[model samples]
Target: MPGRALPVGLCPDMCPAAERDLRERERRLHRLELAPGCPGDPPRADPQRAVKEYSRPAAGKPRPPPSQLRPPPVLLATVRYLAGEVAESAGASPAEVVGFVADRLRAVRMDLALQAAGDAEATVVLEAALATLLAVVARLGPDDVRGPVDPVLLQTQVQESFGSLRRCYARGAGTRPRQAAFQGLFLLYNLGSVQALREVLQLPASLRACPALRTALAIDAAFREGNAARFFRLLRTLPYLQSCAVQGHVGLARRAALARLARALSTPKGQPLPLGFVVHLLALDGPQEARGLCQAHGLPVDEEGRVVFLRGRYAEEGRPPASACRVLVGSKLQGRTLEEVVMAEEEDEGVQAPRTMQEGDAPSPRVPGLAQTI
Candidate 1:
């Protein structure tokens, strides 16, 4: 076999198509050299050098001087406006006010996210904003908000905000007391959670010695031990904001305490317990609340305003009605506003350990060992 001729004016390796392809490949190689870090190019002497370089501005080009950036003026203005609205809008329905406050706070928080992380001035504004929001939330009652608020969601927001604030400022001596107080409030709000207790325990001894924290811990212990008398007593001693923080759990504690009473006091023969004694024991406002609590739990009240506990008749099916504790919490405020309450440093009013009742001093008639333990 012999080789065939290709085309006129073209050699085997010098066809017009091949020539054009060679020119195209050479153009690509030339471009690759101009493009930094292109594959198939020789490695640079400085292996760590950036692959791309940005040109400096021309001398005539206007440029901003390097200076500290601040939080947007609009953000601070919005926070102040919201705070003022919350504080001065007593005429507005609490639900409407709380809704506005919550929405504005969320927007403020998002705005804060875009700010520089190391901006201390911005962090201070954020802390103040969070405090104001938390104060507004803590002060409003469920009935006051009239179902506009999801308490659990609000609590989650509080937890997140507090965490962020702590990360930014908890180490500062000026903030340590406030942070400790907030921690105590958090612990009281989650009284039954083992994790909450563990976190409090992990805090420094000095912080744990904080009056609010110590009181909260004692209350937790009382609750775990099922000491209703001691629990209510400690609850009565909390500061206003702290009381507000734990108020949601009060009904639960009361129900649990009542159940314990029923278990201990129930007999084949019904026992009539005095409503006045219940009011004292549970730290209720009055005999009327005591009677109402008993009735709500399916316990009977006699004509004499005493609760009749019969083991067979007691019902444990329904949630207890919320008792009003405004008198208790309000008195503790001593005429402080919500902002003042939230920002105030806790005083060193020594926390007194609740005294254990002597066997003879048990106010209610107890079955030999059961009442002693309760």
Candidate 2:
């Protein structure tokens, strides 16, 4: 009698449980790949590494108690929902739907941030949800979907949400080059984080060659060099996704340019700038629009169609300057614990703490331990 030769993966000396699990996963994936109408998951260089990268929690944050964290399940649900939407949205416009999905993703992201410095587990979940969102957004054409809200406001939201994700998840995942690059550019243009964009460019050469990355880098250079004309030109030629992604920040950028123009052309009291000059500087449609913008911001226009930007005037009027008032709302208190709300209410009411019984105080309880001590 002779011992039989074991198959390579089935040997008892190797990991039997792991080999079985691997086989099971491969079986499922193979079924998925062969299934009709199943848009299977994207090709990964190493699927197991992908799983580990996402599942392993980043150190430095306390692992949140399982009961307190919803990101894993919530993001899983969101990914499934968005994947379905992406598959079914063949005839409909994707912009609004994508925006809706982005909103949900952002909400989950904010919730994760508030609870703790999220671990890698949460980031992995969020990244999966974001991947689905990116997929939906990628399917959109230039005019296929219009912005769901004011473009400027949406840019602000995307900046915060996407930037946070890039920081938490993108830094660790080496497999998501294209998605990471796009998100990095999104954060750079909307939030103007040069450091973030640079880091993305410093990624593997394969990713740096992305057209979106190149365009974003050019825009950054133009902006940094004070080449407003070039900046605007590059902005005009942004890809469909980049154009939509940067739309929200365009108004902010224009306003900033207007402020710079005002500062450059400032003169002593009573000096005025021609309304046409103001219009051109602000890139407004006409003198009337420029006049309206000036009036709204306390930059008064004279009867002769000349405008004056009074420096330090907002301080004199006991109000914050316009730039200071562009507040970004981070989150609402709707999800806060009832105890937090009660404590806040108590503080507002100036309630004092109930006095505790001191050692000298009377103890009249019928409890065995306290009565015996007394």
Candidate 3:
């Protein structure tokens, strides 16, 4: 019995398929072993298991797979971390932290957009995240930081978040309803998207009745009709939240008007635009402010308080990025010369244009007086 050889294929005949596979694997593993490291060595780790073990997060701090992640929680964590940090804390500046959080929220926004395509719950979460972001912006006011914070990126992310909100609202129209419409109206106005604003104006009368919607519509009207006097008045009277939201865009709109005026009034030879004219056109307080704005934009102003239009092709390039919003607004107004739009609105409404416009006055009937709500 000791000298007897086992029959060929006996193991395969005697064992089940799974047992045979295990035995064969064990035999191959044994063959690869250089030596018996110990009388009973621990079982070798599976190759896949080994990789997973190495890749796994640190012990006791398991993270959900990315597919299972919910963005709002991540965003909240980032915000909370920043909120807890102090001046001497080992962390980024408040501005940097805010910017980083904004970027993360924007990414979450895109994720929300995708999720909202198929799930209503995702839409709700997206809105909550957006609200959180808006609060973050409010808390990081210009005066809050010791160092200057560039709100440009934060503003951009907010605008993009509004876009995501808009999409979610559109998708949830059937199950959700008027809420999305009104919120979207606010967002489109905040974004200063004139074309979108016009489209929304075509919504039902009930939406038009909302104070915020009414305000946004009036602003759009004032801007489109070239009623700088009226637009500025309405801009100042905006509801508290809307006022803060549109501060950047209002500046952008004014800058755009200035750029257009420059291009229109500039001649190949130096022609100075009257400071008074520029002020009235851009809804500025006075020639001094007009001069300041011109200087800020690199437009030369003579000692006589007249803006000297640049000589040639270089003039267009002189405009800032904010001018793009102005151009977009202008195009949305159907390329009407500012005067034409203003005059046409006045004529069509059977209302006489103000004989002599003054600072902070309503330009037409569509614009409310200083004390009047939009």
Candidate 4:
């Protein structure tokens, strides 16, 4: 009676509203998984694979990830169908909306595991969530890094993995793990190629910077900031990074060419080929060097502890970020609207004033409200 507590009358009436809401949102996300393009929504454990258990220094035994609660692929693809849901509800970027929705969904996940306080499940869940969330950040953050992410719970493992990541992928060892780190993981370890990593990273990049690098500098930074599994895994891909560096540009693309040079000389993959064939090829330079390095050395991997490749798509399977709406237009006509534009019904385009460019190349009075370029 001395301390404040819920009034006796407030204790029982219905289920914990917060808990109930959490469960409901999770269920909704689950249902969305049944749709197309969402990856492994009702995730099944791989045939020969199981979630690995990690041992904490305090607890002598290994622990499994608690709340193995990865949201459905629709979570990401929500930008297609359920984006309005987030705009109506969260009203932020696709990543932010997803973050909000995921936050709520995770809340529900946490409630179920609420009693598992200070256990391995709790630690793994929190860590895995953070790692996965960063993967989302990579896909949604502003320009710089845009890449894949692998979550390794161990701090030391993160260090070791970071060493490997710098070696394997072309990157600086001391950077943050954001969009770029995630993108690198997507290509080398998870998605299996730089092309796909490019697509995902493009989701949040401001504009298309042509001829993508082997590993994004942003990625290098992220891994440094992330858990050890990422770092060590990165080390495995150094040779690929080196090859990109060696194949320098032929005078064009100063930024990209410089990035390539940095990758080659960064020193994570291995010692400089003071007299190595790869080094020699780099000196010769160009697309031919890239081709030569591959034929000569085979991407510097000798089949030791490779990431097996995950099949699911994170964005389509989970809640998409708020920014996703920018691209989700219904028809060429109305120019789709989210919450902010909800109150303003767009008028017919034909009725609008004729387009004209002013001195500053700004749209002239011919166009009144919308900003149009010549």
Q: Which one wins on lDDT?
A: 1
| C-alpha positional error of residue 12 in candidate 4 after TM-score superposition, expressed in Å | 16
Query: Taking the tens digit of each residue's C-alpha lDDT, what string does model 2 give over 65-119?
Result: 4333344455444445445533244544556555555555564564455453334
Evaluate model 3: give its lDDT: 0.46
- Clashing residue pairs, candidate 1? none
lDDT of 3 by residue, 1-374 (tens): 24543221111111123432453456432211212243333334222111110122356864333343334444333333323321113334545545544554554454333221343554554554454455345445334344555667667667676667666656654534334333533543455566677557666576555555555666666666555556665654443234434545666667666665555656777767677766554545567777767777767888887788775522334333332222223222344332232212111322112123345553333322221221
Worst 10 residues of 3 by lDDT: 47-56
Question: Tens digits of per-residue lDDT for model 4 on 286-345?
Answer: 334333333232223123312111122111212111221111111221334332122121
The deviation in Å at residue 130 for candidate 1 is: 5.0
Q: List the residue pairs that clash in candidate 3.
A: none
Candidate 3: Cα lDDT at 126: 52
User: Comparing candidate 1 with candidate 4, which one achieves the higher TM-score?
Assistant: 1
> How does model 1 score by TM-score?
0.69
- Candidate 1 lDDT by residue in tens digits, 152-198: 66777777766666565644444443656667776877888998899
Count of clashing residue pairs in every prediction: 0, 4, 0, 58
What's the C-alpha lDDT at position 324 in model 1?
60
Question: Which candidate has the highest TM-score of all?
Answer: 1
